[model samples]
Target: MIEICKKYDCVGCGACISACNKRAIFMHPDSLGFLYPVIDQKRCVDCGLCVKSCFNNHKPTFIEPLKTCVGHVLKVEEQVTSTSGGLASVFMREIINNEGVVYGCSGENAHEVKHIRIENIDDVNKLKGSKYVQSFMGLTCNSVVQDLKANRTVLFIGTPCQVAGLKAYLKGKEYDNLFMVDFVCHGVPSQQILNDAIDAKVADNGNLRLVNRVKEGGKESKYTLRLLKEGKIAYDQAYPSMGYITGFLSGLYYRENCYQCQFARRERVSDITLGDFWDRHDDVKGLNNKKDGLSMIMVNTENGKKLMSMCKDSCELVEWDYEDFIKRNGQLKQPIRRHPKRDQFEELYCSKGFQSAIKESLRGDLNRIRKIILFNLIDSTLSTIPIIKIIYKQLKLIK
Candidate 1:
């Protein structure tokens, strides 16, 4: 059975649980809300499969990308629905068009999201954009195996650790029909924090059903965190929610393993790496500042290169330098630094609540204070002007 270490070990990957033929392994969450595999010793039979499937024990070597670029989908609908470049939609559609299955994380509700399989093109919409929560990976690796075993094409997208878990579960065997795409992940926050945030948003609107991190109809940079009640919109916030985003950026409630993400390096294990080209720079030529938002894609394998070639007909792409790509996407090279107030923040959260944690963390953070001040200043300045209101609404900044 896999040895679950207390600190810096389990990434909640769900590989070992799937690997057990005797159903001897299951996931158990600790106080931090991160799940770790717990082996049922009586049925384990000393088979050692669990240990073999653990990426925490065996790390994958990273390989330099063969090609890199920034791009977005040609379809207006897909471009608008996506969190950034809408590149994921193009990849999903490509696979679905070929009668293949694409696996990704999707929101079941505001409180929970898990990795799911999308076999039809219509279902891919649910998997679009970003749901800034750690998805439960329940037997997804096993499902991927079955799909590949039946000679079906499968495109799997997830965080780096998740991709590694799936690879490790396959026991180093390469599947010809399986295409893996992982992102330059920053970190995953605690599920409890997500639950708390959702509950707080819909205080009187009954229960929040939809929680989107990037709602449509805003400047790509200003996509809102939209929460819903019944079927109507309830909370539409921009940039960050104080409870979730503030605590997240301040390192309040993230899983312990996230602080030390081993996969944050150039030598990636997945076929393609996707991330937002956030810190826009002028040096990269041919990059349409779609400032609408662009996805930085790094092709890691021959399979990835082939896939990129197919994008010529479906995407607006530009070949860019790896250095330029890393300019804003530094998670490609380094792990997120732990916040100095992490311990205090979590303690306050575990004791007081999510809102309390956010308040405490935001204290003395002059940058956030300045942003709030500027926001109010802009609101007051814009609200009084009759013509400017029309122009701002036209710019999609009103809502």
Candidate 2:
């Protein structure tokens, strides 16, 4: 009898279900909105087709390095409305203009992130910016396979692992129209955390209504959240906090396999991988002045180079040295901080869910305030050699 573990390690790839010759495997949805495979061991012949077809255990396709590739450091107008550089949107625009469909994650309602297909350029608005959470793959993999079989041009944008899974699922299949783009992902949070955060916000303010999770705000926008309370506009007090970003970087919020991600190596499955150019030194003043940030562009394949060239006019193209780019945003072989307290704090905050986490975050904020006050008092009592000068400068900047 073939046995399968029904735990967190099972990523719900459904390869086992598809590979079962006796048709014993089936997909079952769990409480976390992820689907896992279930098997009827009684009918199982244990032929091992399921294990052989599993992408999780097999080697993925790799693209050979291109001889000559062009790298661009461009300021995208749409990127201002994006979580990172607007390279994904620019790439989608070109693909859509040629009557192609783009597949990516978009916010639905207020909190949910769902996989969507954008054929019309107008529909591109839905796919903009960072969701900060792991998007449900849903039936997208199956859909992409069908679209490929029909000879439709498709541009699939996702994290490195998702891209690898897609290519692995469609192994031995080739299509000229298919393009894959992966992000320089820090990490992804659980979908449950996102939902809980939104729910907590709504519960806190009875009239709080989430308008849109936007990267850009027009004149009416005061903060990230646009709320209607007692016929008055209210915004999220938390803007640009390190909660989500830090959580991702610390790996306190990703899936079980993300920490040991096989896709983080040099051999990438996607044609192009894009990330924020956070450490660029070219005209820092100009780049910083803009509301939207710049992106670190890397063309991993010849096809990526070709696609990037087509969008030269729309973007401010500049040469980015590969060595410098890697030094700034390259993958870490280990966690950011090896201290146990950081991990303990993260687990306490994250596992407590959003409501409890918010309360703890407030306590943290108070602690920070208390430290600032103490530092100021100490500086005032100590010898005055601009002791508190740096702290004052930081406070002014934050304000």
Candidate 3:
């Protein structure tokens, strides 16, 4: 009788369902909107396969990234549209050009984060940019297995845990054509919170056509968060404020497993790692200082290095110092600091709604309250002038 406990035990990778020969395990969402495995005793064979496939319990071995670079896509249009440097697009172009399959997170319309596949060159943008919530893995593990068995090339990009889950589900079978990529994740917020945020941010409460977090301008541009509708820009704001970004950056919304993540360790399990190169230290010499933003591409395995080199023509590749990059971006070396009110926030969110939960949780937080007060004060002062008032209204700073 194998069991997966809720709240920090299971990552809902859907690997267990793929591993189960008896088909006894099923994923069910918990109160916090995260999936955990549930077992049927009537069909139980006591195979213990599910437990073994768990990335949390049975961790993957470490492998240092083979190569690391700070770079961006050579195509100006692609870079502008991408979240950071447009490297994923570059990699996808190479893989898809070879008629390979690419799997990644995409669920902006449904207001859910789920794994999606892209084989068409035009659909590459579907999986582009960042998804802050934990993506629903579903039975994609089984799909990957079927694809690999057919000897098809596969490029799967996901969080470290999802990558581990896929690898674990493969039962140690290494496919030469398979390329796995993960990123410097700062943990994922719950789906419920994200859905609520969509409702809060979308204009006219329209559908969430696409969720994109892009550094709008080089270096100086604040992240412009957009919730689009039918290719029309309906909702837009500078990110890290108000709804999902604020809660996420404030560390109030994260899965319990994130605080104890083993994948956050310096050594990675995926073939490739992608993240924003903050370059806070300004120590990487001879590179153009693109204030727009650059991606920190860390090739974890030999296979990853080969794939990255193949994309040299697609991107402006520059050497990245390992120590310096890891210094500013600590998620490479360790897990993000867990919010003190994480548990409280979850409890409230489950009991009330996302907005109420987030608001109430922060009510007791004096530091955050002070900061909000200060910002409003400054904003109010600047909003007095006629020109400033117009700018404030345009920016959605004032109602």
Candidate 1 lDDT trough over 10 residues, lowest sum: 279-288
Model 3: per-residue Cα lDDT over 75-98, one tens digit each: 878887777778888888899899
Locate the minimum summed-lDDT window of 10 residues in model 2: 332-341
Model 1 RMSD to the real structure?
6.6
Each model's backbone clash number: 2, 0, 5
**Which clashing pairs does model 2 show?**
none
Q: Candidate 2, which segments miss by more than 4 Å at Cα? A: 1-36, 39-53, 62-77, 204-249, 283-292, 330-353, 357-399
Candidate 2: tens digits of C-alpha lDDT, residues 1-399: 555542554555444554455877776644433456676778877787666555666667765334222222254457556655577888989889988899998754335566778899998877776666777665577678777788788999988767866765665466677888987665556666656565655565453333333444521111243444554555453333444333443444455555556565545578887766542222223343233555666677777877877787766545555655555654522323222333444555546755455444443444554576578456544423454555555664696
lDDT for predicted candidate 2 compared with the true structure: 0.59
Provide the RMSD of all predictions against the true structure, rounded to 1 decimal: 6.6, 7.7, 7.8
Which candidate comes out best when scored by TM-score?
1
lDDT of 2 at 102: 93
lDDT of each: 0.76, 0.59, 0.76
Output the TM-score of candidate 2. 0.70
